[model samples]
Target: MVTSKVKQIHDFGQSIWLDFIDRKIIFSGELKKLIEEDGLRGVTSNPAIFEKAISSSSDYDEDIAQLSKSDKTNEEIFFSIAVEDIKLACDLLAPVYNEEGVVGADGYVSLEVSPFLALDTQATIKQARELWRQVGKENVMIKIPGTESGLIAFETAISEGINVNVTLLFSLDRYKAVAEAYISGLEKRAADGLPVDHISSVASFFLSRIDILVDPFLDQKGLGDLRGQVAIASAKTAYQIYKRMFSTDRWKKLAEKGAVPQRLLWASTSSKDPAFKDTRYIEALIGPDTVNTIPMETLQAFRDHGDPASRLEEDIDGAAGILERIKVAGIDMDAVATQLEEEGIDKFSKPFQQLLDAIERQK
Candidate 1:
């Protein structure tokens, strides 16, 4: 029997996705069980997750050995392995996909374009298309950072009918830009007489990292009590923006053309501050047409003691108040968002390069 809380979360219209992926989970049928038991609807991955998966496991040994023997570069080998795992995941979720139309509870796996290409619009688009072809799965989403150049690449990628997972967004402005890009892409596809219904996308707005970064600043400024507030406030405001943008006439036209709204996905949701409640991010951000991709720890935390009430809807007034208080406390949110964007890029680039280096060492 599904827990009432979990069912309530689904009833509230939010999708829970696992943020981490590993061969053990996939091969052991654990991922399939999550779908069957926990109502898990999707999966997401990044370089850091991939690095840990490849470096810490012997499960990929045979594949790595075979690729090493083929004289392929480490990067090439990495993509090959990642794509293989994603294909397996896609297959595992295929039944769910068929049951619920294209918008169902499964068959979604995200593969990121190189973090090194985050700033190269043209190159990012090129690589995104290439990765799409390489993965060869309809349920796969090409993950792109929500950088300026990434925004351009996002527009082009969606125009070509590539499903996207726009990652690393930390601000309302960035979210709006991503939504616009999705709309533009769908508009172009419709104009070209392409089927827009098959294309889907999600804008990933990172949650816990905001508190991890801003809470320190708030503490140093004598506001430590505000430790867990910024992230939720930020997400609440982002949802407001999403509502506004998708309700506009422009988006309605694209909607008429069968364009799906780029749903808001919460990432980096694992609690970074041990002092905070483990399900703080997950519980606070629940709403309709949204997704929370939880790390294993967070997922377990929610399963254990989470109160999945309609808290996201219950505290709209307070959520707005918190943001007002944050600004009044002299926090430059835009600056912090920009810093997070740079740091977000750096975070992924380092892990991605490390994954490549680890593959090279294996070779």
Candidate 2:
């Protein structure tokens, strides 16, 4: 039986995707069980995730050893292994992907491009296309950071008919740019007489990281009450943006031609502060046309005690007010967002390099 709490999120039009992926879960049938019993809608993997999965377990040793014998570089070997896992996962979720024949509805897995190419538009575009071809699955979304350069790659990828997951979004302005890019991509496709219905994308707005960064500043400014609130407030405001952006006449034309709006995906959702409840992000952000990709621990926590509700649209003005107060507190949000983007790029790049180094040792 599906755990009513986790499964119940679907009733509010929200989908829960697991934030972690590895060979153990895929091979042990754990991923399948999550889909069947917990209503898992998708899977998302990052360089850090692959680093942990490959380094911490012997599950990938055989593939590594086999690929090593072919004189492939460590990075090449890594993608080969990662692609195989993504392909297997896509197969497992094929039912959900095919559910009702709605292309952008549910059942999507995300594989991120090299974070090293985050600042290089052309390189990122090349790699995204290559990864898309390598995975060779309709349900797979190639993850690209929402850097300014990444926006170009994202738009180019979508125009070429590849699915995208725009990660590392922290600013409302950048989020608007991402949505504009998505629309532009679809418009280009439609103008070129290509199929727009098959193109799918998600703008992933990170959650806990926002509060984690702003809380210390809040404490320094003696505004401690707002410690854990900024992220949710930001997310609620983003939803309002989603509503406005998609309701425009421009979006309606694409919709008539079968272009689905790129849904907002909530990433980095696990609570960073121990004082907060385990499912703090999940319970509060449940609403239509959104996804919350959570870690396994958070998933278990939510399944046990989650109280589902349509709370995302609640407190619209209150959400705006929290953001205003944070601004008035003199914490430069745009600068904070800029810092987080740089740090986020570094965070992924280091692990990606470490993962490659580990693979080199194996080779």
Candidate 1 local lDDT, 62-150, one digit each (tens): 89889999978888899999999889888887776677555633457899998999899999999999999998988899999999999
Worst 10 residues of 2 by lDDT: 99-108
Which consecutive 10 residues in model 1 have the weakest lDDT in total?
98-107
- TM-score computed on alpha carbons, candidate 2: 0.98
- TM values, all candidates: 0.96, 0.98
Local accuracy by lDDT, each model: 0.86, 0.93
Q: On residues 1-363, what C-alpha lDDT tens digit does candidate 2 reach at each position?
A: 355688889889999999999988998999999999889999999999999999999998889999999988888899999999999999999899888856568888999999999999999999999999999999999999999999999999999999999999999999999999999999999999988987888999998888998999999998898889998999999999999999999999999998999999999988889999989999889999899999999999988998899899999999999999988989898998999999999999999999999988987
In candidate 2 the C-alpha lDDT for residue 143 amounts to 99
Off by over 4 Å in 2: 1-3
